[model samples]
Target: MSTLTHHKKSVRAMAQHPKDINSFASVSADNVKKFNLPNGEFLHNMMSQQKTIVNAMAVNRDGVMATGAAVFALSYDVTGTRLVTCGADKTIKMWKKDQNATPETHPLNFKPPKDIRRF
Candidate 1:
């Protein structure tokens, strides 16, 4: 039988998006915890809740990362305008709310003709 090392890192299973390979989670030397990939430290900053870490994590179709909480998951909008987190906290609030009335958009329109010229 192989012996487990004392310095072995404590890792939890993390769910990644459909086409995402990189996962992110909060980790630390003591109470650090989160669901992330076994390769990198992407969510190292979101750690330290003075409690337990999220249960699961996943990246949205839009490429936004989210963390599972006691009851719900905390995720960002496609535009990154607001932070949405839901859980046993029984609260629905935004960590970062945007007051801008309009979002950025391309003004130019690209319409192709039915008939195309061949080289």
Candidate 2:
């Protein structure tokens, strides 16, 4: 068996890619990190707007991912195009990938919040 040791804090949840057998994700504190299979190399961090420890995660057959923190549940629609999450704040949030978004418009290098908390 292979072991991955990249998470800096205790992992709270994990989910294998439903469409990519060689890919998976793990939640550590507020970050969701992706990793390659077999070799177990770190790929990158998944985009997240959450500020608390993620307690649940799921991936759909279309490669869409969902993460929830202080959340009771998260799920992907049957079409694999939409994700829904319900949190303790008594709110339900739905997410969809923006097909028109580009790296130029949604750059990945944005600085993290100065008050962001990490384990």
Candidate 3:
């Protein structure tokens, strides 16, 4: 198995185990890797054909959810409230920040994040 790491806040391979609601865990190919949330928590990973060297990784500057494929890209609004993600299947997903929840600790609430398809 190979890992990818890039960007100031985005990392490819998890260096530790998922500890609390402050980190993000990845589940793929029967492996569970742990990742710390950069800037805040949670984000999308970039990939192609579900099997290739991931190109880039970046933090959302805030938080978000995804769908229809492993996240291949991620972006955020200037205020760090809105999040957007692109999946390996070529689907783009968008999420509205939960203004009530703490941005840095939000994604921890949803392990194995559920991707909400943008219609």
For every model shown, what is its TM-score relative to the native structure?
A: 0.33, 0.59, 0.32
- Answer with 2 or 3, whichever has the higher TM-score: 2
lDDT of 1 by residue, 1-119 (tens): 34322212454324454454554333223223333355443443333432454454545555455545473556656665566776677887676634553445434464533332111
| Deviation from native of the Cα of residue 58 in model 1, angstroms | 5.1
Compose the digit string of candidate 3's lDDT tens values, residues 51-83: 333423333433332222266566555665666
Off by over 4 Å in 1: 1-51, 56-71, 97-119
Number of the top lDDT candidate: 2
Q: List the residue pairs that clash in candidate 2.
A: none
lDDT score, candidate 3: 0.42
- lDDT digits (tens) for residues 30-118 of candidate 2: 46788888888888777544557778888788665666678867888888888888888999998888999999998888576554332
Could you tell me the TM-score of candidate 2?
0.59
> Which 10-residue window in model 2 sums to the lowest lDDT?
110-119
Q: Rate the local accuracy (lDDT) of all candidates.
A: 0.45, 0.76, 0.42
Question: What local lDDT score does residue 103 receive in model 1, on the 0 to 100 scale?
Answer: 43
- For TM-score, candidate 1 versus 3, the one ahead is 1
lDDT over C-alpha atoms for residue 51 of model 2: 59
Question: What stretches of model 3 exceed 4 Å from their correct place?
Answer: 1-57, 60-69, 99-119
